[model samples]
Target: MNRRFVSKVLCLASVSTLVIGTMTGCGSSESKATSIAQIKDELVASTGAMAAESVFSRGVYVNYAKDAENPDKTYFYVFNGDGTGSIEDGAADTSNYFEYKIGKKDVTFYIGSIDPIEEKFTVKSSEDGYVYGSFEDGLELVFEPVSDVEVDSFNATNYVNEQNGHDFVYHDANGWSVKYDPEVITVNAGGPMTTFVYTAESAGTNMITATYTVDKNAEESIKELGKALGDKAFYTEGIFPGTEDVKGYWVVLNPEEGTSGGYVTAMARDYMEGALIFEMDGHFGEDEENNMLVSDTLAGIVDSLTFETK
Candidate 1:
């Protein structure tokens, strides 16, 4: 696997405690504590009914801190009732899937195509409505249950600042638009997908491909694209500004030492009778710093995205 792609997928698994973004937490020494073992036992006895009723099996659970190196990043998880979920880093613009089957003493998380990580989790107390948990590896996470309304508030407050702070803006006739820094970015229009290129003077190139769909739902279409990219494909989802149903996913393949064949971010939204799908591909170079530069630049372009269904 390419290091760049790994970096994106593992952004949610970061080891940090800096309070950032819209979440906050406090230490709890007086709250009740339990282990995954106890929870698993209860779950098994209930024949999966408990899963449907458990708060951990629904909505978004966000970490209280952002990545120390990338403070703008927001890490979170969405655990579905079917033993499947996603690890997400919002500001970093990355997400991936994880499958888990509760064991006697731990929960095994299979994220993307990576080797499974077995977490011996000890659930601590909830402070200010934020749940606290510690893993065997000394990694502690403080999670707050976020509602859809809250998510919309967060997106509106955070991403609104990523507007056209660039030298140029591109508006497609297809009811979508993006802002890009003309210093290092160029646009190529006139195709099914509009291409934006960012070339590092000393390293490699990064690209974003934008398009839409009119026949299916956004989430299902993005998942299908991820599966078509192969089992190694990573998945991502999020709400974009001006839209509630816009979802995104991506995949990386043909990895080399410091670069890869392609790292794609596939996103879509259902509008009226059709859907709008947007995609971004980053082809980074051997220079780790330059790779990060490209990633940040492309992330900004994504942040500046705006669209209309009609």
Candidate 2:
């Protein structure tokens, strides 16, 4: 059987924003402990001419609503200044405009619409080291440090279309040839990396598997790389071509043990360009022909990998 080898690479991009606003009364002093009006005046004086602009700066953006037609909910937005913002909900969209002001230092803006005249547009600034926001029904919005910010890139390495001459087809040791095509290829982009998944089927067996690749140089440590693969098995054999020294891992997944199933093997390798990973999965029963077919297919594909180390 012809061993089909597939490689997938997931890239992630980092997005960061620096905020440079001073808290109203960060210094401990009896005179600094004043009313809200005094705090606002101090902030205005410090801003000078820019006080009139009232512009807010952030690295991300978010929006919230119960429904599109009648948005009764409110949401917070963080703008990254790159024309890209993160929405809290996967279903909500962002507005084209953002607002802020110098007088509202250490303050968060809340956006909501209550009525024609009493729209929920207000800013709650900090005073005496305390920040506060007004909310309906005694609801309060608190500010906290952003946690675990991550961005991902597109996965374009594992291209296995038959018309492109990259289809997986191989011959087995028993002289039985088997070939199959993947059902779908999906790319998930997040945090520091990306993931590509390919689903394929066998002709006679109900088994299916996927082949993938990754960049080893992108990760800071092997343990981190292993964590990124997330709940998958590892292996030392069946590595990509020119990546003999790289480590490998995999996970044996079987919903019904002792019936008919397969396992997933993943390998992490270092390429001159970056870290490269490959995954091969198989599912079969006690049929010797099917088992040998899958084994040979995996071996052939691993042997044919070529790394462009730079």
Candidate 3:
């Protein structure tokens, strides 16, 4: 992937943690400890109905903590029921953590700042049995399972040529078709993943835009292809945009003219089941309709994604 895209993704992931920390009341040592203990208790109580043997096999809940000086810096301690526990940090790793028995099965919990730019918390098991908690309201999380298909089985040609092949379409609230195009290419390697790309075209009077989706597992292959395309390929960066969904690193790139706007926004979610990526790029033009059309097009595609198990 492009270096710029990588940077953006990482930045978003980091911001997410900060947002989560604030949301969970990690602003002070006392509040942080209290919130962490309460959350752990909730998990234990929710899983207590299961058999003791099953419970022992499951992990124990440990108190979560935040940095003594920096309220936004949070960490979680997970016990293994046998008196062993592991510590997780918001700065280092934010993806997977210890699993606890919620019912008959063991479910993993993740923590990160994902809203208001600086809050953090643990997600609870929703109706689907998967944890779906978020401190920020605007951000969405999609988790899909990795398919059994081998990475070599993915055909880049077929992927680029599909009828709906990485297409982005925009519609107005009035039900009018504003603009539509399929201009981006996406390739996947193995697990659940997604990517984002932006492209635009100028019509006689308006500008048309398209945004592409790339899977997380597809990063390796995409990077390779990008290299083959020469120095124009994407690269990773240490900074990201926005406050919610902050991460340790991000991926970013400035697309060539006629391709898309100078800036592109991208993010990736690595889950036990699979992974998903979200991206957004705007089209620049004098016409307001063109800009609106491009924004709506990218937003629509992003809103349509759904997560499923393999």
Q: Pick the candidate with the highest lDDT.
A: 1
Residue-wise lDDT of candidate 2 within 1-310, one digit each (tens)? 1111011001101100111123334644443334334544544444422322233344322222222454422243444544233324222222223232233323223333322122232334322222234334334443222323322211111111232445433322222122333433333434433333343334332322222224334233344545555555332333334345654443333323664565554455444355444445456566668566655655555555444332
Model 3: residues with Cα > 4 Å off, grouped in runs: 1-230, 233-250, 255-266, 279-289, 296-310
lDDT of each: 0.57, 0.36, 0.37
lDDT of 1 by residue, 121-144 (tens): 445433334555556765666666
| Number of the predicted model whose TM-score against the real structure is largest | 1
How does model 2 score by TM-score?
0.27
Show the colliding residue pairs in model 1.
212-277
RMSD of each: 22.4, 23.0, 23.2
The alpha-carbon lDDT assigned to residue 5 of candidate 3 equals: 34
Model 2 error, position 40 (Å): 96
Give the backbone clash total of model 3.
55
Arrange candidates, best lDDT first. Answer: 1, 3, 2
Best of the two (1, 3) by lDDT: 1
Candidates sorted on TM-score, descending: 1, 2, 3
The local lDDT score (0 to 100) that residue 126 gets in candidate 1 is: 38
Q: Cα RMSD for candidate 3?
A: 23.2
